[model samples]
Target: MASMNDHPGERAAADPVKLIGVRETPLSVDEVFRAVGDDAAGGTVLFVGTVRDHDGGSSVDRLGYSCHPSAEAELRRVAEKVAANHPVRALAAVHRVGDLEIGDLAVVVAVSCPHRAEAFAACRALIDDLKREVPIWKHQTFSDGTEEWVGAC
Candidate 1:
């Protein structure tokens, strides 16, 4: 198998940030980490948000996500902000939509910087901004047959 170090876009995909749209398929944490993995980067930070079995004491059985077309545009804007604010060598943010079972990955954000402090700061900011700004909604179904539509909750 090809390692993440040998990612196809290593040479040409040199943009400081990358954003992707994928089906409700599984994501590779290692791949996101490696996308920003560079010798010049001293630190890499990543955030993975997973679908949980419960939310606010409600037992969640499954979730469905839908996004506005503007989601992709917003994600790119977030990545751009990170690159501008920090000495980010590379960054990527990916969010999966459609039906998802418990424990499935909902989103992943990764960032690499010249130092650990900057990487951590940038990663945190990216995730926070995304949760607040991204035009995505989650429809959660509970085990008790109750369902709720939450806007980025």
Candidate 2:
């Protein structure tokens, strides 16, 4: 199988976790989950975020994600921070951008550690930090002809 492309602005130095990232195509949880698998890891956690049919009870027609040029850099920073706090064997995260239909996967993150709890915690932190800090915006169109854009200007 062909290798995944490197994340934009990712450093050359080797890291325990691979930083495969920010793209406009569909995301694959299986691909990312596999990247984090290691013989030494006793546990692995994967989190997948998908486009939902509704937002705050409003029916959604479609949604799209737009990422700033610096978004990948921010993702790497967040991932590194999470890695620093845990004994991660390997980790990988990918966030999809562009138009998406309901139920389409939006993001996938995986973390493998020596134990279950740490993997879970680190995976959670990695995702949370990425969402909070990354410069990615979500634009949604509702069935009622209204639209909303979330995240920074």
Candidate 3:
């Protein structure tokens, strides 16, 4: 009998994390979801962060996101944590910088696991940790002719 570590199936289950930075452009939700698609994995969870048109009753016209160099590094670290904590088959995360129109995707996260519960838990944890630990900031441009810089709130 093959040990867990020596088993081919177990070795193939490991998936490395991916992080990417890009200029603000149209994001394909399908692409992100496909990155985590695995035949052995029964569950896949995708999270998309969008630029809402309104914030706290104020109409938001657009948003500008900026990140410290350490931000992308931190995001990679978060993805690594998810892979270590769960049976993650594949993981990918990308964040857009520069100007973005309302309803644009700011970030996309996808995770696949052998079970639905683990997939949901890991997906939620990945996004929650990214929001709290990543150093990305957003400048909200309001329709009232004002702008405010805020953390990934």
Best by TM-score: 2
Residue 55 displacement (Å), model 3: 0.6
Cα displacement (Å) at residue 19, model 3: 5.1
**By the TM-score metric, which is better: model 2 or model 3?**
2
Q: Which pairs clash in the backbone of model 2?
A: none
Estimate every model's Cα lDDT from 0 to 1. Answer: 0.82, 0.84, 0.80
TM-score of 3: 0.85
User: Model 3 over residues 32-145: C-alpha lDDT tens digits?
Assistant: 887777777778889999989999899998888988878778888888987898778788788888888888898898888777888899899988988888888989989999
Clash list (residue pairs), candidate 1: none
Residues 1-153 of candidate 1: C-alpha lDDT, one tens digit per residue: 557775443232247885455446777787787787777777889999999999999899889999888988888887888688777888988888899889989998898877799889989999998888889889999999999998854
Off by over 4 Å in 2: 1-14
Worst 10 residues of 1 by lDDT: 5-14
lDDT of 2 by residue, 1-153 (tens): 224763322222237668569998888877897898777778889999999999989999989999999988889888888887887878898999899999999999999887799889989999899889999999999999999998856
**How well does model 1 score by local distance difference test?**
0.82
After superposition, candidate 3 runs with Cα above 4 Å error: 1-12
What is residue 99's positional error in candidate 3, in angstroms? 0.2
Q: Give the TM-score comparing model 1 with the true structure, all chains together.
A: 0.85
lDDT of 1 at 144: 96
